[model samples]
Target: MCSCQQHSTATSVATLAPNGAISFRVEDMTCGHCAGTIKQAIEGRIPGALVTADPASKLVNVQGSADFAAIKSAVVAAGYTPSAEPIG
Candidate 1:
């Protein structure tokens, strides 16, 4: 539903890799504005956190020394549902 008009078939669940990168699938993110808002929310809570949100993919990737709970909480605080992808 991204206003940017781009669409993607990325996975619809969040994942935390061994390297410490966290990936979240936010189905509600539907535009650059939404992405920005999500980014601000995460970055605001987790200092030095790097967030890359793609509305097209409804995916938000976070990198840095951050707690997974904190990251999810920030996103939830911003009013979005972030689903965690299972790690294999």
Candidate 2:
């Protein structure tokens, strides 16, 4: 019997807003090191960017003027996949 759950928990979803806020999924972040890496990667790419990552929610919220492409790239560079939809 396959005991794996096919459902996605709150920690596996990310929400990005049109007001320069981004939220994405990250499953490997377990410590401060991961947070720092993610922040640095995003800030480095977005320049004056603000990011708040909730490991519990697996969501990374970013606020800045960076474009969606850049933001997506930053998230990928940080070792996470950016979701398709941008939350309002």
Winning model by lDDT:
1
Would you give me the overall lDDT of model 2?
0.63
Candidate 1 CA-lDDT value: 0.76
Cα-based TM-score, every candidate? 0.76, 0.64
* Index of the highest-TM-score prediction: 1
Quote the positional error of residue 64 for candidate 2 in Å: 1.3
Q: Local error of candidate 1 at 73, Å?
A: 0.5
TM-score between model 1 and native: 0.76
lDDT per model vs. reference: 0.76, 0.63
Record all residue pairs in model 1 with backbone atoms less than 3 Å apart, i.e. clashing.
2-30, 14-85
lDDT of 1 at 29: 83
